[model samples]
Target: MTSPDVLDSYAPVVAEWYSANARDLPWRRAGTTPWGVLVSEVMLQQTPVVRVAPAWHEWLARWPTPAALAADQPGEAIRAWGRLGYPRRALRLHECAVAITERHGGVVPSVLDELLALPGVGTYTARAVAAFAYGQRHPVVDTNVRRVAARAVLGEPDAGPTTTAADLTLVESLLPLEPPLAALVSAALMELGAVVCVARTPRCGVCPLAERCRWLISGAPAPVGPTRRPQTYAGTDRQVRGKLLAVLRESHGPVAKDALDAVWGDQVQRERALAGLLEDGLVVTPAPGIYALP
Candidate 1:
């Protein structure tokens, strides 16, 4: 665990740096509603900001509120998602909107527990909306925040593969007492980790926490284990899934199963991918031989 002294020292510096350096993302702008922030968080799960920006704008324009989205068919959401990589997230967002409309009267809930109770809104996302959207004093820990904490506070080269209860506690200890200030600090820490204390190649020279960073003071040791390899996309089941989804998204109505089969040559692999999509609720079979996005 990081000492209280260290935690106190880190917050103001990072928050000040973020005030001057944070990206001009639309969701971060003032007056962005809770729904907009929620949409940005969901779209940013595995997709890059560059890709998510235009898509997010389009999605909000088409369905500006939870009620608007809930009224539309889920398939339209999937179609609008448009190569965001994880189609499941699109379905999850659709379901989330439906729940938000029905449960909260079309308003995005500000409380953490209420956000979590909504479909597809996990711990990280819930905290994010509560802090960023509502300006509550919660630790919004994501991969970036975790990595920043591990290196600056723990002297580790990087964070663990997944976030744990300990990670949340460690980050929460770093927040300021004031709710709005603490939210600013949380966003700052995330921004520092993302653009400065990045994985593989940290730009320590420009990092606000560089002078006090434990990893830097300790001579920046490398990670202990073998490095992880980048994920492959070609010829994988994910690739097959994308191909199948593309065919479905392009069509206005249900497509023939044979049309989907024509996408990939490996019939077995193709069939398995289609079945996975069906099971995931991203695809629906309206009839014996027809397939479509849902």
Candidate 2:
């Protein structure tokens, strides 16, 4: 059983550390709408802050509300995504906006289930929006938070590959009863993991919970087993997909199949990549052998 005292101890220190050290992200600022929070969470997936910030600013400025985005073409969203790597998120966000506009009357729903029902919204995103945007009490378990909990409470060097029901339960146990405080603590835990207690090299000296951390007490054992290698983008199908999409994004209308062929040399790999893009709905066939953004 998780101890209440141990969980309670994390609240004050995490909150204090966050107050002093948290990054001034636009979505975290006061008066940020639920729609803004929703966009940020989606964009942050597998993408870094340095790239997300400007794109986010331009996105919100162009489509400030669910209604605004819903009114635009999904192709526009894809075009505006602008080197964020995963273009599928653009399509999903556009669909989410349409859902919000139609179902929730242009407001981002506060209900967890409603948020989850939207296109591309999963468990983590649903909880994140509810906690961060609506000030609801929820256990927003991301990779960063899971790592923090693993090292600080479980005395483990890292969390497993994916979050589980057990992870949510542990996070719930650590949350404060008050919704606002719980939200702050949730954000603080994520921030702590992102900056101080990072995966590769943790800065234990600057960490607020270093003294109380169980992994630290256990001699900060090095990770066991083979480290997973980062996925390479160069010469991969993903690169071909990006190149194909870039052509469509820059073009005013449907691009000929021949135009796409010029972007990649290997016909087999290039065709596979373009087919994948079409399958993902990031590209659409406006006419025979002519591809355009959806």
CA lDDT of each prediction against the hidden true structure: 0.92, 0.93
lDDT of 1 by residue, 191-244 (tens): 898899989799999999999999999999999988787799899999999999
TM-score, candidate 1, is 0.97
Please write out the lDDT profile of model 2 over residues 23-61, one tens digit for every residue: 999898888899999999999987998899999999999
RMSD of 2: 1.2
Number of the top-ranking candidate, with TM-score as the measure: 1
Residue pair clashes in candidate 1: none
For candidate 2, report its TM-score.
Answer: 0.97
The weakest ten consecutive residues by lDDT in model 2 span 1-10
Residue 113 shift from truth in candidate 2, angstroms: 0.7
